[model samples]
Target chain A: MSDSEDVLATAAAWRAAGEPVALATVVETWGSSPRPAGSRLAVSATGKLAGSVSGGCIEGAVADAAQQTMRTGSPQLLDFGISDERAWEVGLACGGKLKVFVEKLA
Target chain B: MTPALLAALQAAQAAKRPVALLTRLSDGEQCLWPDAALPGALAEAAEAALRDDAAANLTLDGEAWFVHPHNPPLRLIVVGAVHIAQALVPMAQTTGFAVTVVDPRRAWATADRFPGITLIHEWTDDAMRALAPDARTAVVTLTHDPKLDDPALDIALRSPCFYIGALGSRRTHAKRVARLAEMGHGEAAMARIRAPVGLDIAAVTAPEIALSILAEVVAARRGAALARRAAPAPAAAA
Candidate 1:
């Protein structure tokens, strides 16, 4: 199975177990982003994570947003880049821009 | 996220059929297109995504939907566990191909030589029948023996394998062509076999030959369209 399939399967399992789940996907990338546009990360209500969005640079922020999306059941579109002043804050110093979409999974 | 839709996706994936999951970002309404027969505007987008073997967020009717293409893994079947096969297996694996090395000889097709690669201890014809090379598969014959290589080529040429190569010299390939012709294979069909297999790289070593063969296979797989685009157009008839 592919990485996306594994993440989706895990998210499905979590949802079946009555735990809330959220999926964060890198919808777009510019410059030297570590992961491609379709890279995904699955977050469960208990803080369990599967897959990755950025090679450890932005997973923390994505996970945080994913957890919040799980709690509030709302989607979020996040942008991070070296040009942004908050790039160092989010740890994306790879000289690239990434647009991630986080959504709660039913 | 319905149980039925999820089951369908899993079933399609397990069967090695091409599938795409179209998920609307706004409402998260998901639709799975197992084959080419998608509905309306989505069909064109799904076909393009499948053809490109890429996943993207496409906008249609002013709505955004993520078209995630879930294609089956590409496979490489190498007949003859020679030195080139030894080097080619790992390289093909690293390049995202599920490789299988086939050789009937027990000593040659041993696990000690191939290490973690999949080894088939059966004749080429038998192995080819069992594996059933599809369009997403590539077959390479390195045995240099007509007895072993011809049978594999017969099956590979008949199948939808994207790349078929045979390791031999020009004179050997000429003899092979005559032999295959006697078996009723026409010029067009025989043309598909890349004898003196691998690109025109001045490769003298086994590993270098394997690298050239792999480069040719990749070129055949993904570069055919580009080649067509770059080819000069035929003159128009008066």
Candidate 2:
């Protein structure tokens, strides 16, 4: 299938399989985050997901929150910023904040 | 290896296309091991280990579960056969999105002007099957007519179409929402419809507006690091 069809089908299948899946979206970003506006990540209850919202900096945090949202069916807005205090060598360099609005799919 | 799995891997290795592998990790589904680009975002050794144990990793919106990274191209789908589309289509196409412009107006969607693009002169329903709008793809309705835009948005939101934008004014957007209300879409769903689409940048001409709109779409598409960093910031860091 095409890109659009592929993503929809993948997401639908994940939902239909009873997998608690949450959608991660880049609502707002600060500086030089890896992914872009419509970039999305779908995380399953099993901690499996598709796509990328960042190069990889905030994936771990986003996945953890998405798993929580998927099970609770509660949408959550997750924010991540690269800071020295919370300096994660694996985090983004340009120090931008990414707001990922996660929602569970029933 | 299954043909589908093999093709997906090949696509990634060759940069032909980006495909996601959806495998079931729990017993709810029959997915034993998903041999994805980032099968649980594990290292090659770790992913192989997951495969041995019949487990799978997670990913979405470019975030992987384990720890690996893979970057792919953006996909933009434009709906309409208008002047804005004429500008936006090619502009976005150049920006690396696999652009496909869908319109029932054959006269306007011909290839003479939109040469390399995947132009579809068909109804939205027919084209949507192929155009599967997702978080990676931006769906813009420039038809300016609700009959065309509304139906497309209806299907778009139902699917994982991430960015659903329709061209109109703020007043037009309010009016459009009222009409959509009759269709049973609640405020949340309506909120997803970015009417009066594009950035707040002052863009008047077709080219200028097209650039601004595409810029916003890119802004919405990029990750926090790349999108938020202003020009000077990245330079300073460098």
Candidate 3:
């Protein structure tokens, strides 16, 4: 995972340009997860992103979530708890649950 | 993307600093995972195998490992409530350190005394338990009292805090050595204790002493000592 400085810096630049940005943090993790709790990846309204929530599988979805947060100006808590249907979607073999907290900040 | 993250992580890793990433994953109003409860762990054994199917099966440890490219903060535990600690705390914070201070003395160990510090008004063990001191943690005990100093030294010697120092005069330090020996501490462990803490700067004031101590801590952290300027040919051995 990358440092938050770049993410914060870009977010500041976005704010200066009257663009919205969101910060996502993994406050807590359980079982076995790729990233530890407190990992952050920030996204801007312009689709600029820094850091990663998951190794790779989750960033695309998270970037999507970030854009949603930026547009609606509302935060979301996305869960990757595998459902029966989810089994066919992507191989989330790890039984550990990821409680991702996404938020937008001024 | 700014390479700041990689730079910071690489710098910290090279300097032997333990760094943790704090992300803002989701938030109310505008959030990534709204209603996301913090689980603190994730597991995916089946997914791992399936995903590997695409890129040739490779054995990977199922046990949770730190995410690649993620660098956590190094934890430094300062076990004294002294003036030197006051300055050192802020400096450590500025330089990207997760610092904690433990002291039982009421007058010395109060939150107000250390505004932004993770000041703990408890014994060393309790704080260490809650925080779980790691190898990247550096333990510095400044109080001369055995009550505050000894137990901390005990915990630090056993734990992985790279730098462990206790403040004392040479005589006081010698006495401390004797006491630890009496208490069944071996020489090897005692080696970890840096008595007469701080560099030999002959600092007489609090701030100066603070600078000396932190200078040593910085050096110890980087595994480099401030190179002493060349002496003038040693004066021909006097």
Better lDDT candidate (1, 2): 1
Off by over 4 Å in 3: A1-106, B1-68, B225-238
Chain B TM-score, candidate 1? 0.81
The alpha-carbon deviation from the true structure for residue A42 of candidate 3, after best TM-score superposition, in angstroms, is 14
Candidate 2, residues A1-106, lDDT tens digits: the string is 3232344346657767877677665655667776654367778788776877788777787888887876676667566776544426446666776666665655
Question: On DockQ, who's better, 1 or 3?
Answer: 1
Give the least accurate 10-residue stretch of model 2 chain B, judged by summed lDDT. B24-33
DockQ of predicted candidate 1: 0.28
Model 3 residue A13 CA deviation (Å) reads 7.6
Candidate 1, residues B76-193, lDDT tens digits: the string is: 9999999999989888877768789999998999999999888998889999999999888999999999999999898998899989999998778888887888778877788788
TM-score winner: 1
Q: The CA-based lDDT of model 3 is what?
A: 0.62
Model 1 residue B83 CA deviation (Å) reads 5.9
What are the per-residue Cα lDDT tens digits for candidate 2 across B1-238? 1334434544563573433333221211211123433333334533453233222344444543322112344667788878888899777766767788888889888887688788887788678766777666788888888877877877777777657778998777777777788888886687677656777677899888788778778776654332332221111211
Model 1, runs deviating above 4 Å: A1-3, A6-21, A29-35, A43-50, A54-57, A81-98, A104-106, B1-7, B35-39, B81-95, B106-123, B126-132, B158-160, B167-220, B224-238
Cα displacement (Å) at residue B151, model 1: 2.5
Give the candidates in order of DockQ, highest first.
1, 3, 2
Docking model 3 quality class: incorrect
Task: Count backbone overlaps in model 3.
Answer: 59
Task: Give DockQ per model, in order.
Answer: 0.28, 0.03, 0.09
